[model samples]
Structure formats: structure tokens, C-alpha cells
Target chain A: MATINDVAKRANVGRGTVSRVINNEPFVSEETRKKVLKAIEELNYHPSSFARGLASQNSYTIGVIMDNTMDKVYANPFIYEVFRGVEKSVYEGGYNLLLLGKNTYQNGKLAVERVLQGKMVDGLILQEQIIDSEYFKNIEQYNIPIVSIGKLENRDDISWIDIDNHMAGYMAAEYLYSRGYKKIAFEGVELEKIFARERYEGYKEFIGSKGLSVMEANELLQNIEGVICLDNIYAYKILQRCKKINKKVPEEIGIITFDNYPLAEYLQPSVTNIEIDLFQLGLCAGSEMLNKLRNRNCEVNRIRIPVSVNIRETTR
Target chain B: MATINDVAKRANVGRGTVSRVINNEPFVSEETRKKVLKAIEELNYHPSSFARGLASQNSYTIGVIMDNTMDKVYANPFIYEVFRGVEKSVYEGGYNLLLLGKNTYQNGKLAVERVLQGKMVDGLILQEQIIDSEYFKNIEQYNIPIVSIGKLENRDDISWIDIDNHMAGYMAAEYLYSRGYKKIAFEGVELEKIFARERYEGYKEFIGSKGLSVMEANELLQNIEGVICLDNIYAYKILQRCKKINKKVPEEIGIITFDNYPLAEYLQPSVTNIEIDLFQLGLCAGSEMLNKLRNRNCEVNRIRIPVSVNIRETTR
Candidate 1:
């Protein structure tokens, strides 16, 4: 219940000095700043978000524009994991986070207007599904520092962070090939999935360069020894098919899958997987956004959190 | 990019009138308000967060005070489910959400000061773990309208929403008893968990009133026919113990558990469970907060979403 007057009186300074300290404007001496902070802590003085913003014009908040719908965000745990990451780092970085959206949802981009025009936030961390020319222009016009969660292609106007999908795919195949599997095949996913396609291209590029035929699971009868699956469910089905065909896994077939194979360890032949740390992706994006805010002249940075392989009995 | 002057000029009103319309003051005539809105739509002028707040003094934002640590939120999907519910409804209701927390994270309560002192949010949604006497007194001083996610016993100064744990337990026992199981037992959970204790108390009260003795899972050898587990893993363990003891399931030994038995359907005999929709809890909390905001004189509301039973093979 203490007022600014009380803090000013206790600190032996005028009201203007206390207001300046609270607003974070320069000109107060170190001694005066300490006295004001000490008074604030002792008296439990607090200021409103708008009161501070009115004078300093800094909201000291960040906005996350989730360009995906609620359905997609709910279906994918990765988004929440990313949120967990972004929230932790940014909360640690001394900024509030505003999840930008309107009451009547309109694909998410419409939510950007309020945040941009209101000066509601210091910066933004975007989880955009696609970056078309128009969408990119809308964001660019704001001229604020932004860090995109997923990878953006061909432009370095702002920073972006994602896992190296091609590298992950290449490594999955290389790991299998290195384990004495002569005929390694890649399983199928919908060709249009952006991340999956990038990984598939990586696997294909590796297989093609090595003169290996692009094969599916059904072709295990054609003497295929290893099958790397982009999807975990596909891996399990292949495992089931291998069992029905009387092929002994590891001895005759080897399987490796991407992460999030629920109860993957419970399978008769437990599946090995490439684990991409989504939390780390969010963490890097958060800190990167923080870095941009701290240094206005910093160059556009490109970051990719590395993936690790969890080896299990499927490749044993 | 349109300025207030441009919108005012377009509407044939002075800058002050346009500002007044944007500030949402009631003094503006309905006709003038309509003109300003139309001009704003045509010009797409956005008032900054501070500009609107300078006169109206409302932030138009709500604060979600997650009193638990980041780790707990990450561990419990229920928390995130509630968040998704709260976020979806509130966003649809046209209020932005501020997840308030400090940089160092002195737990979640420390973040409340800024939101409370600054009038950063119009109301609050709390996901608290423990409500000690003194800890709550600090919050009570703020006098903001609050909606707590879990049940609050004996205090109705504000509002609280949760599943009816006692009813859920009573229903589970009644279901088993009505299904012709003469001997039933309740499994164990840590004694300190509040919700679990209430549920167990309900089950015990039902059984005691019915003249049946309280029994544990291992007591099944002595003619205990059905076991209701508070935890899913415990239920799975009991299922495994029955298997090892050569007891047939559903035919000779029936079992049931609470929801979130991940892949429960994949078991030999799928487990039956009482499903509590956490998202519903959040939705009610959000709408309740919105109701409180819309009507200052509204009564303190108590809401409990009912639980649904998933009848599977384990209880067949």
C-alpha cells in the first residue's frame, strides 16, 4: 500500500527521481539508484505495467505468434515443449510473455496487429507454420527483432532456429550402414511434410550417392537388412510385418526410427531413435531473441540445436 | 501505419474524438463511436497499449499465476491441458493472457506483485499447489477477482473449479459394487496428496457404509474380487501381479484406474478408467473469470465438471 511519495521520502529524493528509477531512464547516479531500490524492496512498492510503459515506452514483454491453429498446437506436444523452453529462458531473461491471439481466431496472423501497433512487447518469437511472401512482408513491416522457431529458407533478414533435419536423416542411415547392414531401406512418410521431406531428402541423397536402391519395408523379402523409418508408427508396423514374415530382427532385420515412439522400449524388438531436443530448440530461440534485443546492431544469426541418437535393441 | 490524425480526418472528427473512441470511453456518442470504428477499419489504426490505458485505466489482460515450479508444469500434462483450455476460451473472449513470473523465479507468487501493483491484468487465474494461511493473505490484499483451478474448501471469497473427486471415487466403487463384485479394495497413493486423499475418503466411506472391509490389492488372494487403483501404474502393477499369480482378468479378477493410463488399450485386458476432462476445468475457470470481469457485482461461483467412465475389458 506504500506510495511513490513514501519511497521518495525514505530515499530522501524528489518524486521525479523515484519515477525515473522505476521507469528505467538514465541520469540517476549509482548511489541514488541503490537508495531507490532499497526503498522499493523495504516498502514493497510496485508499479503498473502501463504506468511504466507510459513514460519509458517499453512494455518489457515479448509476444509469441503461434501461426498454427489450436488443433495443431494441441495435437503436437512439440509445440508445448517448445513453449516450455521459450517460457523458461525468457522468464529467466526478465521479460513477460504475451501469447498473442484474438477472441475470434483468424489463422493467427491477425493477432499481430494489436501487439505491433500497441507497442505491447519489446520483441517477438514466432512459431509460424509457413513464411509466404505476404506474411513475411507483414512481419517485416513491423521492424522489430524476431526469432522464428522453425527454419526459414533463403532469407537472413531475421534470426531462425531449428534442428538440421537432413543431417539427422543422413546420420540415421549412416548409423545403420555402419552397423553391418548391407541393404538399408528408408520407410515412407507423406511427401509433403516439410520436416519429413527434408529428412527424407537427406536419407535419399546419402543412399543415392552410395548407389543404394530406394526401398520400402515390403521389399524386406528382396534381401533388405536394415530399414530406417522417418515415422515411428511405420517402424512398429514394419516390426510387426517382419515378425509375421518369420524374419528374426537384428539377426536378419535392423530398425531405427525417429523419436516419440510411445512405449518404443516395450516392443519385442525395442526401437532405436534419433531424439531432437525440442526444449532446446525453444531455449535457443528464446536466448537468441534476448540477444537480438540486447544488441540492436547484432548480425542475423542462424542456429540449429543438435540431435542425439538413442541406440536400442532394434539396431543391436 | 495509419496515424490517429489520418483516421480522425477520414471520419471528419477531431483527434480528441477519435482518441476518445479508441479509449472506449462511454461519453462518446454512439454515432461518433461508429464513425471512428469505421474510419479505424478503413485506415487500420492501432492505439498502443499505453495510449488506451492512459485514460481508461484497464489493461484488458488477464494474468495466469502458475504457483508451481516450471518442472512440475512440464511434468504434469494436466496443467498444460488446463492452460490450453483457459487460453482457448479467454482468447476467444477477447482478453489477452499474461503468464506472470520473475526472471530468477522466486516461485510464481513473486511475479504477482508487478501484475497486482501495476494493474497489469484486469483479473487473475491461479494454478496453485499449496495455499498456506500467510501465503494467501498476501494475495488477498491485492483484492483482484481470481479463479482457482482446483477445489477450495471452506473459503468462497472468490471462485474455484475442479472435478468432483469424491463423487468420482463414489461412482467408481458403486460401479464395481453394482456389477456384482462382492469384495472390493482400494489401492494406495502417497498420503500427502490432497485430491487423492479426498477420493480415497469417498471410496472408504462408501465401502464402510455398505458393510465391506477395506482391503489392499495383495489381499485379493483372500477373496478380494475387484481392486480400484488411484494411480494407473499401480493398476498396471496389480494386473501384472494377477498374471503372475495365475488369476484370470475380468473373469476372476477385475481392475479399474483413473484416466491417463497411456496405452491402457494396448494391454492384454484394457483397463477401465474414470476420465476427468482437465480442459473443461480450464474452460470453466476462464469463462468464470470473464463473467467476473463483465459483471463486478457477480456472486462467487463454484463449478465442478463431472467425470466420465471408460468401460473397457478389464472390468467386463
Candidate 2:
């Protein structure tokens, strides 16, 4: 119900300036823009959304698709920090986020297509498991910008934000090896996810180069001492099995994994692993998204968040 | 762009039947209604939102306002699971969720009020912290139905869903005693929060029953051999300080805390703590909100989620 005049007064700006800002006209300085936004937010102004939509042809909304829904792994502070960064950037850019859960049934295409067809969002942030190249083709037809958090095989043109999975795996293996761990094992999902594959490759190559044959079980999961996991759940399962085999972690074998989920530390001996800077990933994604929304050209793309090895009771 | 006719065809139902189902008119059987809704969701048919808005005077949307934007303890799997449960129930009931982050600025009332006045939502799910009471009052004026995940000290009449914090605290003390931990400490935020204060009282009373006195650290902290913490960060800091003073965990002292954050498992020896059923909380909140929105005479409020102990490597 608040008019432009009230907003202008509260923002300490001229009425015409407020009008221009409301119209989203160019040439307004960043300081003036901040003032207008602050006043608008403070006054609880709801601009005629219908009118703004007709004039600007933009919705100022982004759709975020995440694979995990309210599980313990998503409870990690790292993921939340990234979300905070994403939220902060979006608020500053005057965009709101709509979260869509990943439909394991592959039926969520309805929601995705609806948002696209209705123009409900200006962009999409995909955080699901890595998909094949064909899925990218399907998404590309929508013509809206998308930024994926996980790598998609055989696709490089699209924007993505991820962590260096290969290096993280290498680091885990090297760290375990340096601590005099000879027998180790890797445990993760059987899925063909890009992250999992890359980390597996890294672990394999590093161990192979060290003149040691990677052991394996004669059946089921043959020939593995140290364990590399796809997620914390699988890692926990591996731990339970290790106890059955009388293999104590970091004593007879070592363990490591990606996506330092919250429950990792609570496990006995505490799983020492690498930590991804998810906040930086979200910040980078949001920045690129804002640029895409404003039609501004930016060189940012395919950013990889760094990782750190969190040494705990699991290793030593 | 898909119409009711498209949904009807996909569902193999008549157009008239689809119309009746969409409008919630009489004569449709429960079985038929389920089929129609499944088809509608599958087709992503947003059935006459404009018409529904005009006729029913309600938007099929609910706003969720959450506190603690930082990943800290708030990122517990319990919180996310609750949200997931809420999401599933609401979407099935034909409602979309709008997530609003707690704006930390000094003047956040305006933003909170805007959600109500702007007609962006028909109801609200408020997750409040101790410091956000002023903003809470501003939103309460709209008199729209609200269900909170946590309780407000001053507002007794509002509907809320919460875990039994007092019982959880009592249980933490009991767990330590059963484990032969005689001396105990309590660490959490300043005693302004109800959860912290209540939990501490529970611990004190239970320990006192066993004829044990809690050690005091001058004025800074209540020093004991074991600890029941409010959050992981405080638990980490407390444990670090305890180590500096030559107090070893589980060996010299035992520890328990409320809210098992993801990183709790990754910490050395992991952390033994109380786990609230967050998913059930969300489901209960969603179910209650739906009931309130559907019926005018429904006066039921105040639901409590159960909590459980996640026994990990922290205790003997």
C-alpha cells in the first residue's frame, strides 16, 4: 500500500529517483540502488507485481533443485553456509529462491517444466547427482540459464560449481599412506556419479603408483583394504562391516570420503576426511546467476571449491 | 499451459469430473479425488490459481520463516528432516512453500510484516529464536493461522510444535549416570534461551537426586567432569578447554548434548547427544496447518515431537 513518495522519503532520495529505480532504469548508481532497496524493504513495499512483470519481462525468481531432502548429511554446516551465501547474494540481487526436491521417481520433471513454462524463475541451480549428457540436452531446450553444482559427464559448456574431487581423493589416500596405513578400503555408492568415479580413479591411480597392489575381497566387494565412500551412510555401513572383519580403522585400515557429512564425526574413531567449501560454491553460483539475470557479461564459470583434510581420531 | 482437460485425458477421467475435483465440489469419491490429484501433480497443472484466489480468498501458499541462517546447530538433520516432512505433506495438500530467511538487520519487523500484508501466503510456519520476539509480534497482528516449530515464552495461546526439551535434558543426565559418570558440566549459550535453561535445570535436578554436586568455575561456566551442551560449537570449545586443563573426554569425563549436528560425528570420539524427530515435527506442523486452514472450528494446537538418544563413540 505504500506509495513511491513514502519510500523516497524514508530512503532520503528524490521522488523522481525513486521512480527511476522502481522502473529499474539504467544509470542509477549502486549507492542509490542500495538506498532504494533498503527503503523498499523497510517500508514493506509490495510493488505492483503484475505491472512489473509486464514491463520487465523478468520474474526475479530462481529455482534451486537439491537431491537430498532433510537427511543428516544435508545437516552439515558446510551446506548451510553455502545456502546462506546463496541467499545473501540473491537478496541483494532482488531475486527470491524456490526450492524443489529431487524426485527419485524421475517424475519431478513436471515441476521443473512448469517453472520453466510459467517463467516462474529466471534461472535454475541444480544440485542433484550427476546426469548423462542427454539430460543436459533436455534442459538446454528450456533456454533459461542453469548452474549445476555437480559435474555432468561429456558436458562442459554449461556453468557448474563443484569441488576438486580427484585431488581430495588423492589427498585422503596420501594422508593415510603417510601415517603408515598399509591396508585401506573404499566404500561408496555403486552409482556412476562423476564425483564418485573421479575420486575412485584418483584413489586407484595414487595407490597403483606406490608399487602396492590394491587388495580386494575374493567375492562381493573383492580386494579393498582402505575404504573410499560415496557418502557417510555407506561409510557407516563399511565401518560396521570392518568390525565384523576385525579391521579397526586407522589401525589395520584407514577410511576417507567426500562431502564431510555431519554424522561422520559422531562415529567411533570419527571419520577423518576432506571438507568442501560449499559456501564459496554457493557464492560463486549466485554471483554468476545475478550476472546472467541482468544480461551482464561475466567471465565466471565452472568454479571448483577447495577442500581441506580434517584429521581426527579416525586417522590417528 | 496444461489444462484440466489435459489432466483429465492423462488420468482417463471426464472433464466435468476434473472440474469438480479441482474446485473441491461435492459428489467426488475419495478414490476419484486421489486419482485426480495424482494426475494433476503429475501433469503439473496449476488449476485455476487466479480463479481460486478470487473465489476462495486464499492463495495456496504458506510462508516459512526460520531463524539461525548460519549452518551451526540449526543445520541439524532434525531441522532439515522436519522441513522435508513439511514439504511432502504440503505439496500433497496442494500448497507451495515460500521460505523466508531471518533478516539480521536491526529493523526486520517490516520484512516479517510484508509476508502477511502482501498476500504472499495464506498461513505461516515460524521457526523462532530467543531474540526475534519483536518481529514475531509484528507478524502476529495479521491474525493469520501460524504454527511454530519452537515455543515463544510470552505467547501462550499460539499453536506450536516442539520436542520435549525438559525430558531430553533429564535423559542426558540419566544417560551419563548410567554410564558411571558421576561429575557433570553444562555448556550452552547464555541462559536466555528456554531450551538451555530448562535442559540445565533438568540436569541439575537429576544429578542432585543422586547426591552429586555440580562443580562451579568461578563465574564463567559450571564445571563438572561430564557435560551436557546446547550445541556442538560450544561443546567443541568446552572440550578443547577441558583438554587444556588435563581433563580427557570419556576417560576423565563423559559428555552429552542436545541437537546432533552433522559434524558431531566427525569430531574426535564423536558426540553422544539427543536427537529430535524433525521430520515428524514438520509433518505434524503441516498436518495441523492444513487442518486449521480447512476447518474454522479446529482449536487444536501445541504438538510435541519425541526425541531419541544417538549413542555414538563419545560415551564408554
Candidate 3:
């Protein structure tokens, strides 16, 4: 419960200057105003007794911080399902979500600070793998609860609810194998994060430990009988390349992909996809966030929602 | 500013119950708690003086309300582009966005009231057409500003920014004509709102006034020389139908669509689309909300962002 006096002292400015910035009045220089704001953020100062109390109290708002840029996030169908699931759970738990993108690198190192500065939300939901080291830096100080959508090695302390990416990858390979394709290869983006890496690791483990054949893209088209695409976009692109080269599917090669959205079902020959319940993952994440809100220190929970294969024309 | 007594009297409960509810204590009856919460919401009551002042003051938060359900809204790529634009403008303006879906009918009437109850946001940026009549129910009393993404005949009073849908329709027909297609037809979903209708109306106007030929999906496939798909999904479906029937694009039948994202560029012969700057529309919508926040009683402004034709293999 920091007051205006504390803000003024920390900012090295007069009490009147602090009051001016708090009241949003004129006569305060930009430098002085910024200093006051920084101090206020640092001290978690609220102008009135209630504002200060509200800082420690419940706002009943849950925030979502997407680690990826807007283009990457919005273009994919994964968010739509996951967010809807979250929305369903949050609303059911009497909470509303604040959407934030991590693209605000210059504004603040971590977007989570925005809510902490205002005491705007009781908890937060982090989507995707935690890449930036700055994300959970002072998370303990603010005492805000967080739940991740995907599991990573570095994000061990946080309560995470995720669909088993490793299992999903294994299932992609197994599905193609059952379709009678013997020499299987895996296709993935050149540079990817932990979740994508987990998928590749899972696929690699299942593809036979001894004498692994060449599995890269060009090699995949030439040497492999079937290919498991790690990404939906990569799957679509491979299909395009195959078509351009006049390679016949299920005859020359068998193609299988995971979590294809907005297009895979409609893509010509209608892609054979491993449909993941991302919506279920989102719903569970929201429920987990509520659990964190209602009962604090109730042991960090780890959950894995199930996945299944949606067989289509790409595979025999 | 509402006092605790106002809430107590209004809720027909003792001051202690009201205080308990305000402090989020246990032992209050669910019925009585609902009454107190409703009373608090209706009266805009805050327990502390600073909380009361903060309610009337700027929360420095902007909200985005999508009037559609999760499945319908998330399946489309429009939200990704639009919201990113809103995020850009709002962050630059030093504000954060609260994302709300209108699917909470049983929980509450309108999703916008969730923010208004706590004075959580200074303004809101609405995505898509306003279908629900209850949206702006008590907007005047709240004094929070709003900017809409699309135009509906009913939502004329609110400040709105939109792409030229009618012009987009006309452009689709014009593009087909330039590509040597004599007859053009329009395909849309069975049920659509103002935005979709506006596109059809614009295309119809451009297709010729006297004795318009039958332009339904079946008729377009058989009789019509070319077809302008209203929705991106419809465009993909039409292309799939063409592939099934062995209809060669730009030769047997020309095809054109609007605002195709994530898939249109990848859909085989690809797709010629009318590209709308939905992100820019969102940016302007956010900027408009800021302007409204800065200068109250400002005249409402309706802006139309420009559009362009992305020529692809679909239409020669």
C-alpha cells in the first residue's frame, strides 16, 4: 500500500509534482511525469486508500499474453480454438480476459507488467512456449498466477495445462505407418520453438532408433514414401510443391499433418490430419486459471488433454 | 459517485452484507450476493473513495467486443489482422485492450457491460456488424466512447470505420469483366448480415441493371461464365467444386474473392482477391476511440479504409 508521498520520494520529485501527475494535470514536464509514473509503477502506489487496497484485492480479470507476434498468432487456427475454450471457462468462472501481445518489446520488456502496474487482473494465461527470459522475471513479487498452454523445460515452476505435443508427434508418424507407408520422413519449419522441437523429438524417437534415413524436405520428396508435417502451413506448402512437380499423392508419397485449421479439410485431396483438441486445451487452461484464483498455493497442477487422428485422402 | 448506503438501500440488504460483498467475504447468501452485485453494478458503487473516483476516471483501458460466437469468429482470419491493428494503435496510445465475446447471454445481457460495471475501460472498439439490439442499451449514462469495425443500418449513430464492401463487390465483378468473363454470378452463405449483403448489392449493381441472369451457386456453375464468391470459405468451396468437376480456372470459369487470408494464396490455381486493410481499419478505430476520449462531444466520424485487387491465377 504505497501512497503519493512514497511515489514522490522514490521519483526524487516534490509531492506537488507527484500530485500533478496523479491528477493528470498540466505544468509537469515530460521527464518529470515519466519519472513519477515509473516510481508509481515501481512502488505500486495508488492515490486513494481504496485504490491501494484494490491493488491487493481481486479485480476478477484474467489476462492472456501471447508470446508470438500478431501475424504469427492470428494467421493460425490454433488460437481461435484455444481462446474460445479459455473464454468459455473464464466466463463460466465469472471472469473476463484482457488480450495482450508480446510484440510490445519497446513499451515494456514484459506485457504482464501492464496489468501488474494497475492491479488490473487476478491472474494471467501465457500462450505458446516461453522464449523470452524477461517474462516471469518478477512474477513472484507481484504474486500473480500464470498457466501456460504449452510445456517447456524452462517453464517448470509455472502451473501449465497443455495438449501432449510429444504424443501428438508420435501419433502423426504412427498414423502414416498404419496407412502402409514404410520409409517415413518428418517436415518442419527451419527455426521453431520448444513445442515444435518436442514434436520433432517425439517423431524422431518413434521413427526407429537404428539407421535413420534422410528426413529433410528435398530428401523427403525424393527418398521417403510418407512424410509427417510438424506444422499445418508447412504441410500446405509441401502439398503445393508436390503438385507443382506433378507427384501423385498416396501413390508416390503419403502425406499426414497435425492440427490443420481453416484449410486442410478443404485442401485438394483433403489433407489427412491429426486433429488436436486445442479448444479443450484452452478450456482446461481457463479452468486451471480459475483454480489458481480460488485456491492459492494449492500445488502447481500439470494437465495433458488428449489428441486423435482424422484420417483423410492424403494417405491411403 | 455512488456510496455504500445507496447500494445497501438499493439491494435491500444490510450495510454489513454490502460491505462483505464489497470485500469479497464468505457467508453471504448467493441470492443476496447476486442482489448486492446487481445493485453495485447498477449504481456503479465502489467501496473506497479512490475506487469511486477511479470509476469515473480513465482506467487507461480499451476493450474489444466481438458480437459473434467463438466458433464463427475464430474460424475466420479477419479477427487476427483487425485485432493486431487495434493492438498497435491502442498500445501506441498508451492503453491495453480487454477482449470480450458476446456469447455470454445467460451470464449477462451485453458483454460491453462487463467493463462498464467496474469502469474498467475508457472506451471500446467493436468488431463486425452490430446484430444484437441490446448492445447500446444504456450507453449514454456510462459515457464511454465506442468505434465499430463495420457499418450496419442500425448502428449509424456510433463512430465506425470500415472497408468499402460495396466497392469491393463492384471491383470483383469489374475484375472478372476485365479478364474476359461475360456473365458473372455471386455466391454467399445462406444467412449473412449487412456487410455480406452490401458486397452482393455492389456486385449486382456492377453486373448490369437490365434483366439480370440467375446467379446462384448451381446456376453459376452451369450457366454463368464466372462467379464472385462473397465469403472466403465460399471461394474455397467453389474452387473445390471446380476441381471435382474438372473446371479449369480463367478458361472454363473465372473466379474472384475478397479478403482471403491464411489459405486463399495457397488454394491451388490460387485466388484473385480484393484485399482490404482490416488492420488499418482497426488502427483507425482505436485512434478514433482515443480522439473521443480526448475530446468529448466530438462529432461522430465514419471512415472507409481503401481496398486493392490482388490478381492471382483464379482470374487470368
> Of the candidates shown, which would achieve the greatest lDDT relative to the real structure?
1
Error of 2 at A132 (Å): 4.0
- Among incorrect, acceptable, medium and high, the docking class of model 1 is acceptable
Q: After superposition, how far is residue B113 of candidate 1 from its true place, in Å?
A: 3.8
Ordered list by DockQ, greatest first:
1, 3, 2
Better of 2 and 3 by lDDT: 3
In candidate 3 chain A, where is summed lDDT lowest over 10 consecutive residues?
A47-56
Report i-RMS for every model: 4.3, 5.5, 6.2
Candidate 2: interface RMSD equals: 5.5
Best by TM-score: 1
Candidate 2 reaches a DockQ of 0.15
TM-score of 1: 0.80
Candidate 2 lDDT over residue span A50-154, tens digit each: 334434556666777655534543443455456656755665566666655554221243445544555556788776452444544565676787777766555
What's each prediction's TM-score? 0.80, 0.66, 0.73
Candidate 3 backbone collisions, by pair: none
List DockQ, one per candidate, in order: 0.34, 0.15, 0.16
